[model samples]
Each structure stands twice: as C-alpha cells, then as structure tokens.
Target chain A: MNEREPGIDRRQLLKGSLALGMASLLTPRVLRANDSSTVTLPFERGRRPLVAFPQKRPLMVMTTRPPQLETPFHIFNEDIFTPNDAFFVRWHLANIPREIDINTFRLTIRGRVKQSLTLGLHELQTQFEQVEIAAVCQCAGNSRGFFQPRVPGGQWGNGAMGNANWKGVRLRDLLQRAGIERDAVQVRFDGLDQPVAQATPDFRKSMSLPDALQAEMLVAHSMNGEALPLLNGFPLRLVVPGWYATYWVKMLNDIEVLNQADQNFWTSQAYRLPANPCHCVDPGDALTDTVPIGKMPVRSFITSLENGGTIPGGERCTIKGIAFDQGHGIDRVLFSVDGGQQWQSARLGKDFGDFSFRPWEAQFIPKPGHTYALQSLAINRIGESQRFGARWNPSGYLRNVVESVKIHAS
Target chain B: MIPVWMFLLLLVGATGFAWGSPANGNDREQGSILNLPADPISFQPGPGNDLASRYCLMCHSAEYVYTQPPHPREHWIEIVNKMNASFGCPISDEDMTPLVDYLVTQNSLQPSPSAQHVQRDDLKETPGQSSTQSGDPQKGKTLYGRHCVTCHGPDGKGDGPIGQALVPPAANLTLLGKQSDQTILDTLRNGRPGTAMPAWKNDLNALELNHLLSFLRTLSP
Candidate 1:
C-alpha cells in the first residue's frame, strides 16, 4: 500500500515538484487579498473547509450577494453525477428569489403565440411527460481565472461545472400548448432574477426560433432525481443540453416568443465571442465582429490525483479522470505522461449519453525519483480536440484548453 | 492501486457524501427557501473616491473595479461613460473626469507574470522597433491636451467622454508603450477597424502625430 507524508504544504510541494514544461499546471490554491493593499492574484486556488450557505454544502464562494459558488475539484473524483448541493451557483443579477412559494409560482408562456398559458408548479410537473437526462452544465467562464493577461469578469476555477440527471418536461411540449406563431423569429427566456438598479440590464436571453424547438431542450424542475436546490433554481430552469450555462436560464418564469430577433443586452452585447475558429486573438487585438458563445468545445480533467500529490515509486497506479464535449459526444480520451510527446488511449467508463461526463482510467507504474507530468486530452465525435494552450477573449468565455496536473513519485 | 472493496464502496456509498439531503423533498407544497448572503464588498479609497462610492456603489460592489486587469486612464473614462450612457448612472460631465481619475489611480494592472513569456508580436502593425526620439515630449503633451484628452483622457488611459460611447471603447494609450513607435504612428494614421477610433491622417500632420506619440509614452505607469 502507498503512504503519503503528512502535512506537506501543497505550495511547497508544488514548488519542489513543478517541472520545466508544467508551469501552467500549478497555481496557488487561493489568491488572498493583501490586507493593506487589497490586491489579489490573477488566478486563485479553491477555498478549503468550504463555506456553507442555504441548502448548499461548503462550496468555494466567489461572491455572496448574487451567490457565485464553485464546486471543489476533489468532488469530481467522487461520482459521475455531481450532488445538487455541491453544484456551482452563478447569478447575473443581485435580486435573486429568496423565498419561493410553490402554490403561487407560475410559469407564464406569452408573446407571439396563439394561446398564452400560465401553468402553476403542480401542472408543470404532472401535466407533461416526465423525462430524465444526465447532462453537464458548465459556465462559459469555467476557467477564466487561469487566463493570462486576465480579463475582467468572474474569475473562476474548473469547478464551475457539474453533471446531473435533470428531470422535467420537454420545452417542445410547453411550446405546443402555447401554439407558437408562424412569424416568431426567436424565443426569449426570463427568470425571477432581477438587478438592484433599474439602469442595469435585465437578465434575459433568447434562442433562435428553430433552435428553441429542438427535442433535447427541457424545462428541468428536478436535479439528480430530487427537487432542485434553492441555489440551483428550485422551481424550474431551462436545460439546453450541450450548451453553456448562460443559455440555461434558471428560476425561469417567462418564455416569450419574439417576432423579430432579440435586441436585449445579454443577447446583443454580452456573452459574445470572436468569429475566429478558436475565438482567440492577440492581446488588445480589436474584435469588430462577433457571435454568441454557443456549444462548448472538447475538454478533460484528471481528478483522481490531486495536483502535487505523491505516489509510491516502482508500483503500478491507476490514473482516473473524466472527459466531455458538446452533445457531439466524446470520441476518445488520451493520456500523456511525458509532457505530451506521446499519448495512449484510456479505458472508457459507462455510457451516460453525449451530454453527460464520461470517466476514463489508465494504468501507470511510476519510476522512482521522477516527477510525473500528466495531461489529458479529449476529442469529440466531430474530431475537435482540446487546444494545448488556453485562448483569450474580452468576455473570457469558452476556455476549453487541455488540462495538466503533476505529482511526485518518491 | 485502490482495493476492490474501496472501489465498490465508492460506487455504493455515493449518496453518503451528500451532507444534508432535505427531508420530504418530493412534497409539492414544502417550497425551498433561499436566503441570499448580505453584500460583503465595498470600494477602496482613491482619487475621486467619493464619486465612485456615490455612483458606482449604487449598482454593484467595489469588487468590479478592484478585480479588473489594470488599464490606462482613458479606458477608465470609457468604462465610466458606459456606466452613465448604457447603465444610466447619473454622474454629470464634471463628475465623470474625477471618477475616471480615481479609477485610473486604482488600476495598476500587472499582466500575469507567467504569461509575459509567450506574448505574441504578430498582432502589432510593426514589430521589433522600440521607442525613438523623433517627436518632442513638450509639444506632444500640448497636442494631446488639444486633440486627444476628450477621448483618451488627459493621461491617455482611454477614459474620454466620446470614448465611452464607442462600441469597443478607445484603446488605453498606456499599453502602447510595448508597441513599436512605427506601429503607434500607423494606428493613428489608420484608425482601428471595428472600433470608434478614426483615421487622423488628415486631422494632424506627421510632426503632430509624432508629438502625440511621444506624449502617450509619458502616460505609461
């Protein structure tokens, strides 16, 4: 059996074991603000001894008011389905619903429809076909904290993502009842979330009319076979499989069908990406034309071993992790143990659909006195692979670079 | 390697990891109550500190200003104007300058140290040439005040009234120090595309452009 030395500082361990090519692999656990100057580092590590709030387990708190919480990296190693309480929380506005009355809650479907229907919470659950899907909901800014020349926005670690079994009615079913008008050009979504100041833009987003009618889209009320957590949008949240979390509106109350394209701030200005293939450009390069951030790219994370953790030398060890992509599905996952000079395929775990996280495992026998530089690369069915380096954008969206981690073998 | 029993325990004991699973979660009327945490963030004191508190603090926390990557004074002006124009903050034209001044003092952006190594040169119009003593700094300062201060800010931080109205906003002049002198000259002659900056080829003579470039160099923190 392998044993680790007790109480080795993770920072000192990283300082000792960080390889020449693995500089990007290591970061401070948390970027603490200096007391006098109040300055924080560009990137931050996860907060330990997690802070608990509401129905949530101790999560890494990014902000308290709107409640931006991040999942701890270690929890990814536990199960394929991220627990509801452990899931991350992100809110664009400050006035999030504190107390939701189930009896009075109504989901109003109006605008550009023949019949406008407002359904209560009970009717929303029992009236439609109950379906369950295991999908991943990841923020567009999942790894924004790691960005070099870091941009302005919520600086987040990899924990801003989770895979859960979502249970609800198909959005198509709800739209059918409302009878969408032929002139409808787009479908807009709004939630109970509102800004404190009237000047601040309301949190609203829209999908093209055709895209909104897709069969996979859902109005999820239950996560992981249980009622949605208060922080995770208790009453209902839209589940747009394979899309970023921004498109998945939580605490949903209004579904308006627009005859013309949406001109809202969230759609017209924010969450936009450069038209480039990787959406990357040099720092300060002008992005004149842009498009909305849509489907996510291929990504993988080695969660089984903690960064700078130690392993027993001359003994075989199993490297386990998870890989995912947009609903195109994960084609294969490759592990690189020698700074990406070579790669070998890892064994795939159970199939949980294209939108769900797919776990993988590989065996490695460490050589004594050598530091193992480990990396995982995932490719989707469309042959899209994770980039070796992270890209930059003004909004800091859709960062899907291949992840690297290192461990010492003593 | 992990023992088979431990592996089995991982799969079987998955639910145990959840600290508190609510009782009667399936009950329809037993609604979940979420109490949002109080706002614990406040702004740091700097120049025009009261203006920042009066205008900016009304909408969001001070974390927004403190967390931004350090930018030039002109950039702060654009941001302030955006707050006024886009978000409808009631800061008048007089208060705008001081608010921007405060933001510029606070923003001492340091690029990620690790990221400095891979900095790309291909993005610039002209590469490799450093600053040269072609323009007079005194003349440049005068030219900046007359032609540029309204948009690029008096300090060239891009915090001008018109700059904030632009879609992409004005470029922070302080960051231009890393560019070749020729690149800065060309950008002035041929304004950036997909932005509000316009070509100044006809607006200023070559000597005046050089003078403005020299003055911009002084704005670098």
Candidate 2:
C-alpha cells in the first residue's frame, strides 16, 4: 500500500523494500535535514503474535491491528526442520538495526568482573567456543492471551513461539574472560536498539550472575545456521533456553557484571514473579518484592489439535505438542481427555540437545463423532506442576499454566 | 497456526480490586503454572488490563508499556508524568481536572503508558531561539527536514516514523504550507492540540521555525 504513494523517489522505495526484505542495497541516499519524509514507524504487533507472516511469495499480508493466524496450524515441510525464509520474524521495536557492520560494533563487559571490556561482533563470533543449540525462544507473554480476565497485551492466541538452531559463543567463556570479580551478584544486559521514548532511550535489561554465566547461556549470532535476521538481533542476542523470551535481549551491546545488582527498573522493580498463589486478591495486598523473572516456570502446551480444533470422528489421530521446563528439565508430560479427569502419560521424544526445545508428541484414536476437550500438561523434575488456569499478577508474569485444546468431531 | 479456542481474558488484576472469583494468594490458579504456585493475585482497576499497562498505556501504546512489566508505580507515574510534563501532554491547571478525571476514572491508578518518562535536568530550562526566519523555504526545508521527516514524508505527506501507527495518521506537512502562516506557526509553537505532535516552541528556534514553515508551504499535497 505504501510503495504507491506519490513522489516517494526510487530511493525511498529502495529503503522501504529493503526493510520488507525485498530489495538489496544498491546506493545510499543522502538524508536531508529539511526534507519532509516518512520513515518506517515501529508497527507494534500487539494485536497478533506475528504481524507479518508470509502466506505466499511477493504477497506480504499485514494483520489487522495485530496480525493473527486465522487458520489452524497444520504441520507441513516438517522434514528439514523449519525452512530458512519461512522462519518467523519477531521484533520489539520499529527501529530494528538494518545492517550490522561487524567493524565497529562492540560488546561492553563490566560490573562484577575483574576488568570491563568491549568486544566487537567479529570478536564475539571468533573468540569463544562456537556452539549451536536448537532452542525455542518464546516471549513470556507468548500465550498471555490464554490468561483469564482478558488481560490485554498482545492478544497472541499462540504463534509467539518458534524453534531455531542458534549459533553463538558460550556466555560463560566470555564471563570468565572478563573474570567475575568477587562479590559479583548479578549480570545486566542492554541492547543497541534505543527505544526513543518521551524519555531518553533506555532500551536495556539485566540478569543474575548465575543466569548470565550459566553453562547454557549463549551470545548467539546465527539462527537455523544463518546470519541472524536483522529483526532478530542480526549481530547477536542472548539465548536463555527453557526460560521466557524476555531475557533474550537482541542487538546485544552491553554486559555488566554487578557486584551489587543494578538498580534498573527492568531488574529491581519489574519483571517479577507473583507474591501470591491465586488470581483473587488486592494487588496492593501483595508485597511488591522486586525480583528476577528467573527460570521459566514448568509448563506445557498443546501444539497440535488446537483449541476449537476439528477432526474426522472415529479417525485415529495423534495429539502432540512441545514442552520442557527451563533449567530443571522436563521428566514427564501428561495428557488429559476429560478436562483433567483420568490423565494419561504422553510418549516422550528424544532430547534435541542442550537448552533447546524438545518437541513432544502423543497419539490417540478419537471416539467417532465426539467433540472432546484435550489438554496437555508437563511437570518438571523440580516438582513444578502445570495447573489448568492462570493467576493474576500486577505485571502478568510467568504464565506456566497448563493450556487446554478443544477438538471438534465432524 | 492461531489457536481457534477462545482463551479466558478476564484475568485477576493487581490494582487491589474486589471482583471475580476472589483473588488467590499462596494458591495456584486451576490449570495454571505448576505446583510452583500461581503468581501473586493482582487487581488492576481495568479488569481487561493489568496494572503495568493500565497506567502506562493511557498516553502511549500498550506494546511499549507491557513489553517489560513488574515495575513500581512510582516509576510508572514518573513515566506518565514525564510524557505529560516533558514530551507534551498539553494540560494546564485548567485542564488538569479533566486530565485527572480521565485518568482517575481509569481502572488503573499506575502511570499511563506513553513516550518515555525521561527525567531530564534541562526540562525546566527555557528553549533557545533559532537563527532562520519562520517562512524561509531554504530555512524551513532544512528545519522541517530534521524534525519532520521521521513522521511526515519528504514531500510533506504523512509517512514519518510515528505516522504509520497513528489513528488518523499524521498531517500532510506539504498541505499545511498552503494554510495561513498564523495557523502553521500556532501549530508549530503549541502543536496540534490532539495529535502526537509536540510543542516545537521548545525544540526549535525562530530561524529554524521560519525555514520549516517555508518548506512546509511549498508542498501542495
């Protein structure tokens, strides 16, 4: 719809096309100060989990408000893992870093480390042990819509999660290189993508020293064995497998080792777990204890046979989904047919590697001509039981609730 | 694929509300996160909204407010007031009652989601004047180019950075050039009353204003 606008020179067309991953960079346009021009404002995909997903070639369909997948997800092209171009694109800001000039990009290391240093993209790629982990990064708010009280954020019915084989240097090795100073309490992270707010640009976050220096932590550079997508933090991003996608700060720039944790809002007073166990209470009654949104709470979800799903009655069909608790691995996945009554153990799949998402599947022959409610739940070895409903938190933190799928019979 | 099943949206909020199935603390919601226990019960004044968003979203986009949550209201209020005081909320003592009325009526008492709530030491400082006249095309183009291009297209169309997300979109800058100088100047100095346009009186100087206004006049579309 935009390329047709009058007077937008070929240069602007080139820029717009490039942003849409359409054209290649041919020549640079000299940006004039007084030239009134339109820029790509960040179109936040709050209405849908993934705003722009390719349904057909050259046919870039934009979702209404926030884009949502109207059709049920059917597994196709499953053989060679997720196709490169068909991979999902997730962005949090409009000003996504277009190009990563590995030349001057630097990663600063500070805080509870013996020495603070800045490493370039090239250094990040070549200096440490290059390892690739097939993991899935999901926004904590991925299935936030699943929460009751119709909490408003991204009305993502699902779609916010994606599995990727990420390549990068181990964060632990880098931390050791910086030498964690004694009394180190936490490690903080910030991105180069400055969110220009009414206030100054403060697009940043932090992590505990243990979480940052964990063996599984990685400063990723590639996804599905390719250079990171510009929107996915081209040069680098933090890969906190098994945890919510929040800590995976993209366009990674700063890594601080704090002897005494940083007092930033992202860490101190925000992104915390609930102070109560139920969704019924005065939020003011709950003590606002600022804490880290650590290891994703153990949870499970049904990928196949989605809510309101339909299947041929009597046809033997398999119910499937991927589930694994971060840190404390998943020991068992349970499936229920009668709304949590009579739970059956689902067949577990082979582990796909470290800090990576494991896709689990369970099969069942549906009763001919019967609409059944299907539910999948997982329990981490830590004994965290995935519940059936969600609770209320001031911030809506950690929705590890067990998700239910409604299957319809034809 | 998007899940077809309609999920429950009526979540318990954190703003100390007294609704729905009484709040639960030290107990997990049925079918929610494992035995690890349900998150603390929250009561946002807005049932559909959580505290973090209810407050912050009033002035800005919900996407900006909710991406990161669990912040204290002080910080939230700081952000709300920041946009109101610094970015451009356009309210005075006279309008304060209406403004607060709109806010207090909100289910959320937390800060509104808005542009950054940056606390700058220089906000109280008076703006410096520009060198160019307000209508000089060369000067106007130069000034407008720097400040207007992000939301308004180079040719004066509404296609800048924030323009795409706006409801009515931004005004076509080039078209404004045809309007009276008084209208243009007033809009520039005080900003369009109901838009995302900030008061340029603080960000621009007289000469810069002249140049921006002049360039804006040239574009007919």
Judging by DockQ against the true structure, name the best candidate: 1
Q: In model 1, how large is the Cα lDDT of residue B218?
A: 84
i-RMS, each model, one decimal: 17.1, 21.7
Number of clashes in every candidate structure? 11, 93
TM-score of 2: 0.61
Badly placed stretches (over 4 Å) of model 1 are: A1-49, B1-24, B28-33, B65-81, B104-221
List each candidate's DockQ score: 0.10, 0.04
Candidate 1 at residue A47, lDDT? 27
lDDT of 1: 0.72
Residue A80 displacement in candidate 2 (angstroms) = 10
List where candidate 2 sits over 4 angstroms from the true fold: A1-95, A198-201, A276-287, B1-215, B218-221
TM-scores for the candidates = 0.71, 0.61
Tens digits of per-residue lDDT, candidate 1, A293-391, equal 898888999989977789999999999999998898898999988878889999889989999999999988989889988999998899999998878
True contacts kept of 2: 0.01
Tens-digit lDDT track of model 2 for A1-410: 12122443333333443343222111111121122311111222222122122110110111211111221133311422343334443443333343456677888888767888789876776778898887766666655544444443444434455667888999889889989888987887888654323333354677767777667788997777666544456568888887777788888988887777677755665456654444333444454544556666666667665567688877678777777667566778998877788788998776776354556777777786787878888877777777666765645556667666787777
User: Poorest 10 consecutive residues of model 1 chain A by lDDT?
Assistant: A21-30
